[model samples]
Target: MSRRRLPELTHHGDRLPAQEERERVDMLDGRVGVEERACRGLLDGRLGASVFLVRSPGVVDGRGELVACTPEACSRWVRAAAEYVIVVNDVSAELEAAHRRAASVPWWRYVAAQRAFRDWKTIARRYEEVTREAAEAYEPVAREIGRALAEMVEIAAQERARQQDETRRHRSVLAARAFWGWSEVTEAGRRAVYVFRHDVPRDDAPEGAAPEESPHVDLRGLRRAIVDLDLPDVRWDGAALAETERELAGIGFGRWWRDLFHEDFRTFTAPPPARGSSSGRSSPSGGTATGGTGGFSGGFSCGGGF
Candidate 1:
């Protein structure tokens, strides 16, 4: 038999209702906040699960009977896991970039050294601020994604139970036909089988049957890191800001301000060729802080192509 194509999924379009069609279009009207656009874009990338449904053996249940599942179920599992990983990496990258910006300036050492300085007192302050922002932006969305994943797991379990029941019911009807001395190839046996197809709830698994694996394992593991993130307790304090301003005015801030801008430009711009060097600026020692994504380097292999 020819395989059937499952329904196609759009990134963000399917999320809106018929009444909100205009609202989706209006998002490009230049009035949407940058933060909102960024969050939406991060959550709605070019990603989807498999498009075909095929049956295959899944994990063994508590009764040791290997459960069967639709291919889409496993595909969606991997997709949800991948999305969870991506959200965590995005938040980590944002926090790291903020730290780099603050630390790259020459005067950062001087400012960071003063523990009593409430304005930019601790280097931890930068991390705290960035983490809070990330949490506020992503916590709710991450929870929604986790909820979708748990629901998918439950659906798969329910479908497995239904299929198992159907198989048992068919077998029982065949047994009955045999006991009645009716050959399956005969007209009477075929009629019995047809009648049994419409039978409802005759072969449900008995009480204390095999239990399926817990869906919460994925939610509690590394896949659901965002849901378990330790959000910072930082908040805005006007008094601290006033103190920062007063401190800035007390020092020769004008010179330091110009140096800060210059340092930023130098740090970002490509270097000019070194004089009299044959091999053009022999790549800086220790490889010049390449800003690689080390956070996502391991343990992110999705079982299916996510």
Candidate 2:
């Protein structure tokens, strides 16, 4: 079937009639408003229009030549373009063509639709069973492992602080050696004296006296101690395994029910309770009759052998 084109009205004359110019302007404005409204409606989830406008030299040239690019090329161009221009020459015909093309079913889609329910049920059941079994089997072990891991983390933090202190000490010794020089101790302290004169005085010392210092110890012993204090391997018990299994089972069963039923069970709704009338009256069993107004408050006779 032939496509119907959109009505086009143009005003070219320099001294065109006011009515003609107004008509043209109105048409253009209407088209712009339609496009904007469509975009807004789509964003707001109120409409489902897939029309896209492109405003690029390439698209203009293609439209002029009535050329259709490959889907991949069109996508790339659209992404790269800054503006989008309207070019709906035959909306109905284009829509019909798309419908015809979509009428052909793809093999994968058919297969997927056929297996979707079965797959959902199967997966749900399998996960539920597995989680239940795992929870039963591993809860106690998981708890024990968690406790051990926490302990290991605490030990690691402590060790890290100790290692940092050791590193700082080593760097301090290197800085001291650089400042004091090689001959500070053996060569009658000439180099040391020269360095001291140039450097700022230590906080603990008098202006002329050398800084009192601790005897230097090698870092090899410290490194060995750090290495020996490695994190101990964690062991799990039956109780921890049991606890983990229970948690896993809970999660798995919930998911399984949801998937199998294809409905959310997490939310529960209870109907409101039935209301009674303000009036009171005696029921057959001497209880207040519902929605009635003749009872004890109204001075009705009591059942005291009157």
Candidate 3:
């Protein structure tokens, strides 16, 4: 929907400029009132510590109406734009760093990072953009955000599936490769030993600096890369993988759901529709699905599958 510019209010003899008025509007629009509650979920892991706001269901009304927004409306919109400034000294470098940190973390956390990144890119971004527009006096189109949350959960499920597949699938690793601080004497040493290492991509590494390859002194994998000086059938369980199918399936999205949605909302009442996907053997609908795939329960955790 288009932004609607609320008429600027005058104080004494001074008149606020149109741009300043827009700025004023931005701050008040979509802003949580001091009385309203808020909860934050820091993007877990190295996804670059980004922050977003999740709120309770009151500021927004039943007909998509917004209730008493702010009493200090005059100053709020003026500072709104200034409030949301994301500055990373280097974009690519930061993203790469976050990705590196993200590597080898819990499968569930990696999944959370994926979702958080997308949220930062989309939903969270949208909220900010909408606030900006609202400050400009443009009204956001109202829709059931509950459904949108469902879609996010669905994408999470898909990501989990992908991770599972990647774990069991074969990955290519160069043979006779130089491992950090040491060269693999695979041919001379034990053939059964599995080695793990962190290899940063050339492009991500600093200019002209040979990419650092940090090899784990501990054997983390078990494969026959036994041929010395030859590229034996080397592969990557690709590191950062879930140790077992049980761990993979054990991760739950319940907390994520509850955190994003309040207890009263139906979406928060049960595991996402794919309960079995993350919660092992349970159905996504939770309990017995006596009706069409519905979200309702006595008291369910949001740990659906984050």
Candidate 4:
């Protein structure tokens, strides 16, 4: 897909006189905020460190979304530009030293030194041109670049908030699916308890939630509800789970129903029994579908293939 473009930062108008353009550029420069100032300083080899490194800004994700950049990533960009400046300076110094020492050197040595100087001059000139071009490009649009970045950040924050809200609203539905997907029967004081994995906490979970209390919803009730619907023949197995998930999607539940194993929504009910258990049956291994494939089924069950 074609990457979405950011707002154009270049000016558009009748060409101004050189003096007027210089004045205009200076006025725009004055409008640069702290982050922009730091960025400019870094480009000019002024600041050793700045908040721009911490801010990290972000990049467009091709779909017009702003993806947050890591500090490490931001540092790489700064480092590349800084290294270019250092290279140019170092090469210029080496070339100057070579010229000064040429008169005292042997003929062959002077020839080799002159050849090396030519290469260094080209390298230094190229790096210097790049640095100058970068500064020139940034100077005119510094204010606009800063404004656009701030807007992008705000948009990203709002997008995150919207997503969090959507997740919060659908958490109950996710919990239900998670129970159906991962819950298993376990012994708890001679009673058959439905163990639902509840390890992953919500982003907006209550502060100081009961640490000892495990989150659960008795899915046995859901099983009973299915039976009460007079669908007693429905075997809640892997096939049934697959069909139910498909139906949920068909009815506008979207892709959320398929997120049973997603880390954010999944639970760890309990560990499975060893291959051979007291009942003399092997626990299901892998996701190979077994049992009779005849007739229709629905709901969930800890028995058979799943």
Q: Evaluated with lDDT, which candidate comes out highest?
A: 4
| Residue 135's lDDT in candidate 3 | 30
What RMSD does each model have against the real structure?
37.7, 35.7, 29.3, 17.8
Local accuracy by lDDT, each model: 0.28, 0.28, 0.29, 0.33
**TM-score to true structure, per model:** 0.24, 0.20, 0.16, 0.30
Candidate 4's C-alpha lDDT?
0.33
Q: State residue 45's C-alpha deviation in candidate 1, in Å.
A: 28
Worst 10 residues of 2 by lDDT: 13-22
Across residues 1-306, which tens digit of lDDT does each residue of candidate 3 receive?
001111111112211111222332322443332211111212221222211112223532332322233435424422332232222212222433443444424545656656545433453344334434433332111112233334545877899999867743421122123332223323232221122234422211212222234343211111112222233222122121212112234332233223333221222233345334443233252222211221112232232221
| lDDT tens per residue, model 1, 50-118 | 111111223212322122223343344334333433443454445444344444444545554232233
Off by over 4 Å in 3: 1-143, 171-306
lDDT tens string, model 4, 100-182?
34433444565665665555446445545654665554443443344556776898789999987876555545445533322
Error of 1 at 103 (Å): 13
TM-score: model 1 vs. ground truth? 0.24
Best by TM-score: 4
Model 1, residue 2: displacement in angstroms? 71
Q: Which tens-of-lDDT digit does each residue in 1-306 have in candidate 2? A: 111211111211112011111121111211111111121110122332222222222322332212233334334333321121121112222333333333333434755433543444344345345434533443443343334445645877899999878755644453333222100121222211101111223222212333244222222222222223231211112222232224333333223223333321121112112256333332332222211221112211111110
